[model samples]
Every structure is written in structure tokens, then in C-alpha cells.
Target: MIQNNLEKYTIQLPKKLNFVLKKIDSNSNGIVFITNLENKLIGSLSDGDIRRGMMKNQVTKYVNINSKYINKKPFFLNYNSDVKKILSYLESKKNKKKYKCIPLVDNKKVIQDISTIESLRKYPIINLKIDNSEINNVIDAMKSGWISSAGSFVSQFEENFSKYLGGGYSITTTSGTTALELALKSLQIGLGDEVILPNLSFAASINSIINVGAKPVVVDVNPKTWTIDCNRILEKISSKTKAIMPVHIYGQPCEMDKIKKIAKSKNIYIVEDAAEALGATYKNAKIGLHGDCSCFSFYANKTITTGEGGMVVFKKKKYFKLANQIKNHGMSRKKFYFHETVGSNYRMTNIQAAIGISQLKKIKSLILSRRRIFQYYNKRLRKFNYINLLPENNWSTNSYWLYTILIKNLGTKKREKLIKNLLKKGIETRPAFYPFNSMNIYKKYCSGSYKFSEKIANNSISLPSTSISHYDQDLIIDILIKEINKLI
Candidate 1:
């Protein structure tokens, strides 16, 4: 029987360990993790736990055969215990269950389980704040007749974008998808080449690679940041590996510093799929600064919107020229109607740029507004008895385009029901992006069991994150709590 108060050690259940492992399926090793309420890992449960529980019939047959079972007995180790002692304890626990790891109860515990999937499962669902004041600037630009993509507003938008990233040349494109294609084409990465990316990103990123006749080597994500694990890149790297596209997912920036070094060592190109990350920075350097070419999305739901637009930024002057020409349908010299390269029409209209320019000017305020909403929701929703707030660290600035929250103990089916209930109350909520590996078109290209992705995918829902009002927040929160309580 489990003791309420463990003397030598205090055995406590993890708040998010199960959730984390659900996001990143156990590797072949079959080890599960445990973390505290703050998301700090306390210990691990091993395959042995599963085997023992099954042998003893401690777990229900209907329960997943793969799931780990925690021993009711308190497992404890002193904080001062060394690695060897910790290993000994784990070995001692080994039996028919074949458990290989035991987690420490406290920070001082000898072996805290940091290896579990739960330790890495939390990510912040942000609210990308919009600047209300920038609206006036855009209105002024519009009234001044600078309402097209080619006007001074476009230049201002590009200038502001570049300045935000410490000075990179920015070329506006019509959409995020087109922006990626523009980047790939400008970098000369096409047929006979392979571009490696995450199966977790928006399909647009993958589609861009395929559009250029380049094969996409899709890999799973880290389940922590929901970004591609850099280690996996080498396994897929080949002579045909022309570029590595690490998508900055869910307002979290990819580990660009390490990715850059690896790409350099392999002599491959790095393309920043910053479509979801407009104001996000990496090591205070900003995202687009690292890639050979970087892309941003200005879709309605993005950090900023020009209704339907995107931009490609780069340091290379040649790409700027190529992108400009390519976005203009391959026209170089108007007099001779010179077509320098085969390209398509992917230009953002001046009208879109005009709005974008206005939006850009108001980015800081918008970010702050989103942050405010995030803090409020984080503070309020997290206090609930049956909810788990996704985690976010300060490594990168998250522009919360959508606010995500994990409904504790509820599966996807239940989450769907919750969404239905919220909809009835006029409260809008969304699910995080579906696992890309599950998509029919990309299944063949996907490798590995996206256990973590599948698990979180089931229980998670995104809340409305529009920069509205505190009143809206309170109403949504009240409705959500009421609906969830009824179900819980």
C-alpha cells in the first residue's frame, strides 16, 4: 500500500509525467518519467514496472500493455546519494518487473529522473498580442494612398522587419508557403536534393519542399519544444541533403545555434521556417538571422497579418535579387521582358503591405497584450484542480498566436466534447496542430513512433488568444471551468 507520508523518502505522483511521456513515446527502452508540479522531474518508471504489474495483475488487462506502473511502496534515496548508490537502488528494484530506474523524491534525492518524456512535455500556448496603436499608423498610410505592396509602406514594413532582426534584407512574399518556396528556389535547392524537416510543422513547410521537386526527409520532434531534435539530422543527412529546415514550432524557437554548426559541418543550407515566429528571438539574436534564407508569415492568425502575406529575409544580396525577380514572375528587365529564372507570381499586394506595415509598427504592443493574456490565463487556468498548463521557458520569446492548454485526465474524445460545449457558449478553442506523421500523404516518409505527439494531441486544446479584453478572459474562463467541472 502507498503511504501518505514516506519517512525516508516522500513518494509523490507526478503532475505532468504521464502527460509528457504521452507526447514523446518511450524509446525502445520503455522508461517513463515523473515530474513535479513545476515540471521538474523526480524519477522514472521502467519497462520492468510494466512486466511486474502485468505478472501480478496489478494493472487491468484493458490498460495499455506498454504503460508503466508506479510501485505503491515509497521509493526514496537521500539527496547526497552518488550515482553509484542510485544505480544500486535501481538494480535492487529489478525483479520479474525488470525495472531499471528509481526516482528520488526530493531535489536532494540521489537520482532524480530527468530522463522521462514528462520532463520535456510542457510548451507554452502563447497569445500573440496585436498592437492597437499601429492601426492608426496603417490608417494614415491607407489615407495617404500608400495602399499597395510596392508602396513606401512596404519598404517601411521590410525596414522594420530587418531592423527587428539586427539588419537582414527582407523581401515580401504573398504567403508563408510561397515565402518558403521563394527561399528554397533562391538558394538553388531543388530537384535531386533532400531537405530534412519535422513531421510536426504545418504542412505548408513540407509542401514547399515538395513544390520545388525536392524530397522531404520527415523526422519526429523532441516532444519538449515540439521542434525537431538536432541529433536526428545526421542520421538523415546525405549527399542529397541540401538543406535542413528546423521549424520554430508553437512560438518556441528551434536551437538554431547548434543547428547552424551542424549544418555548416555538413555543408548544407539552413532555412528558417519562422512562419510562426515573427518577433521570437534565439539567443537574443532573432530567428531569421541564422538561416541562409528565412521566412515569416503574415496570415490572419500569425504574429501579424496582412490578411494573406509572407516575407523572405536573408543576408545575401544575390538572394534578394533572385527573390525579388522570382516573386515578380521571373521578370528581370521590363524593356526586354527578360526572364532570368523560371519563377511564379507570389507577390504580396501593396494593399497587404500597407496593412502589414501598420501591423509591424504595433508589434511590441501586440506582443505585450498577448503576454498579458497569457499571464492571466496561465495564472487562472493553472490553479484548477484538473488542468495542466503547458510549460514555457525564457530561452525564446513566444508570440502566442494560439493559446494551448492540456485538459488533465481527458482524452481526445473528451477534449472534443469540451470544445463542443465551449462552442455552445460562444467560446472558441482549438486543438494543437495534428501530428504530421499521421497525415496520409506523409505517412510513408514518417519514421519512428510519435508516442508523445499522439498522447498530447489527444488531450490538448487551444483556447482563443485574440487580443480582446479581460472581460472576455473572465467569461471564457468561467464558461470553461463550468463546462469542465460538469464533465470532471
Candidate 2:
């Protein structure tokens, strides 16, 4: 087996032979990497080199205390080298599996990380499903010459989305961020207002609050659902708290009932950031209806894609009207350029809406596929007891936007290495959103520690989750199983 203990596998040149042996364990198969003061990799020292140095000493152990048998020309990979290339290089070596770990170095040869062969597999993670239907719809919209911001397809997209979600007004926007901005703006959240949000969410959720001139009150997330901690929101709420932007992160619902009760009592509005959760339902109720207004993203990677678009779903016509006015540069539907209020140009194109309309038609099927993908992954991975697959409470249905797993005892460094390895094999994996407190931009605003968010961010890895062949999934699982075995 490759000795993965880096502390035992790295050293500097001219170290005392005995000391180096003790450090790397003279009998161990581990090799010590040597670096200069600038942390540039020079070479690697094997245990055999140490034994040979001892043998070369004419006076035996008393003759020389130093090692001169270093392999000055050791193999190392450039940092961020594709996993596939590294695997090809390793397969050519004698001990293919054991020699798989390679030092990833910068241009100056400074160590960045390590990649292993087991983590690199040929099976891909996710595949985008854009076939004839998407193409046909876009072409038809384009040929009609109504591909601009306003068109019949835009209304059709909004109508279809609302109908798909069990009835609510849907206001399409250029992007998810714009949709969120419109929702918050409709609620009148501006200067001196605070929006309670989970620190574990994507950057867009946080940015929208800042975009609306509202201070973001960072709250910890629930470890189980990886959603906003409803309990934590109370302590962060103040007189200035205007809204709770609960992001249904990675296709799971937050404790909506409890959060709704809290919001109702505090008289604070809720703007559900359902960017990653398009079709998820909480307690038999679709997500869009619970909040004062909910937002959905149709970014290429979401459960459904409008290529680049989002929707603000409103329960009340007033909010929808306000969002529509804001989206169209304050232009009223009746009188064009009859400026109503200071607004923005966040309108979605008819071309995009046409695609969205087509995509929304298959929303139910798409979500079912996502859930099936999760279930498939869960079934294969559950036997690996140490892995925590994405959480799904009894009351909620997951959209499984990205199938996520948390490996116990794995930290950020190892998690990244694992991801790099997956990338080598053409499998595209991503780390979970880093905690808000972990980011420097949010440092000035963050008050207290977010313990759970930190833990989840460090340990989580997201698998590629799209429509793919069962064989591909099985191959992914097989390789993943092999890699997880090494983690223990």
C-alpha cells in the first residue's frame, strides 16, 4: 500500500541518515519528498536510498551520518494537472496503484496537493441533457422574430411555471440574482434593513441582500438538512430585520413550518431562495406558496434550464406587479416608458422564456429523475456506513439538484484532493459551498461562529447528478467505493 502519511513522506536534503529513516520509517514503503527553503520540490528520498547510503559508507554506521543517495530527478505533476494525464503516467510505472499519489506543484515546483489514481476514473459525473426539444423551441422563437425582452413566450413561460408549481404568479428575470433582487425590492427591504439568511448558501443568495442595500445577518444551518437553522434565525433577528431569505440548498427544504411560524410572529417577510430547489415540496405543499415570494433559478445546472434565467413566484398580485414593474425599467404594461418608479432592466428574453416554457413542461419528470438519481446513489453508497448521503426528511421531497455526500473524518484538504482525482478520471465533482465565515468578504458582517456550516463545508462533496446511463453510475460507484476504502 502507498503510505499516505505526508508527514512521514516529506523531508529536506542533507538530513542525518538515521534521522530521516526514523522520520519515514526505514522499513516503510513511503518515500520522503525533499524541498528547498522556498518550498520547491527538489527530489524524493526512498527508504532503499537510505539503506544504500548506509551500505556505501566505508566505516559503516560510524563513517557518515548523512544521505547522498537522493533521486534528484523525481516525478511530480503540475498543480491542477488533469487526473487523466496523471493516471496515464502512473500506469506506465512498475507499481501502478502504489505509485499513484503524485505531488502537485506550482511552476516553481512548490507543493500544492496530491492526487491518487484510485480517485481518477473514466466515468463522468454529470451530463447536460440538451437535445432536439430545446433546440427546436429556441429556433421557433428566433424564427418568429420576437426574441427580445417582451414576447408571448415570456407570458407562456410564466404561466406554465406557476401552473406547474400548483398556482402562483411567476415573474421571469434575466437571472436568479435579479429574481432575488426583485423579490427583496418588492418587500421594500432597503437601507438599514437586515435579511436573515443561511451562511452555508451560494454567493448569489448573499449578494442579493447586499444588492438590495440590506445587511445580511448570517445564521448557522441545520446539520441535518443543510438548510437555514430556523432556531438560529430568532437570535439574529432585530428591529431592522425585514426578511428571511431561506435558501432550499441542494434540493432539500428547510424547516419551513417552524420558520413560517417564526416569521409570522415577528411580522418579517420571507423570500425563499429556491434557486437550487425547483420542484421540491415541503409537507405536501409546494415551496413557492410558503414564502411572501420565492425565487427559482434556471441556470444551466439547475433542475431545469432556461440556459440563463430565473422566476420570482408570488402569492399576491401586488408583489408580482411590483416585480414586473421593476423588471421592465419601471415601464407599465399599458404605457411603455411611462416611468412608474426607479427600477432596473432585469427582463428575461423571449428566446430564454421559450426554452423555459419547454423545460417547465418536463419539470415533474425532471425532478423524478433527480430523486431517482439520488436514490440510486444512496443505494450504492449506503453500505459505506461512514458516508452521509444528502438528507431527506419524511415531509419533503428532494430535487437532488446535486447529489451530495459527507465523508466523516475528511477535511478540506483531503476533500479537494478527492475532487481533483475525480476530475482526472473525467468525473466532475465539486466541493460544497464554503461557509460564509470562511470567506473574507463577509468577515466584517459576521458576528459569531457558524459551527455546523463550517463542519458541512469542510466535509461535503457533490457528485455529478444528471441523466446518465446506469452503467456509468455503476462505474462511478465502483470507483467511489475504491476511493472511500482508502479514506479509512
> If scored against the real structure, what TM-score would every candidate get?
0.69, 0.75
Could you give me the TM-score of model 1 versus the true structure? 0.69
Candidate 1 per-residue lDDT, tens place, 1-488, comes to 01111111222353344443343243444554444455344554554665686697665533332335663343555432343444444454533332333444445343322211121111112323334555565677678775655577677778888987788899988899999999999998899999999867778999999999899998767766767778788888988999999888767788787788989999999998999887877777777888788899988788788878999998888888888888777887564577888888887776677778778767887777777887789888877867766557677767665677777678767777888777655456777677777779878667776676665566778886754456557757877888888876
In candidate 2 the C-alpha lDDT for residue 349 amounts to 93
Model 1 shows how many backbone clashes? 18
* lDDT score of residue 316 within candidate 2: 92
Residues 223-341, candidate 2: write the lDDT tens digits.
Answer: 88889988889999899999999999987888888999999999999899999888888998877889889999988889888888999999899988988888878777788779888
Distance (Å) between predicted and true CA of 329, model 2? 1.1
Q: Native-vs-model 1 lDDT?
A: 0.70
Off by over 4 Å in 1: 1-149, 333-336, 384-386, 485-488
| lDDT, residue 375, model 2 | 85
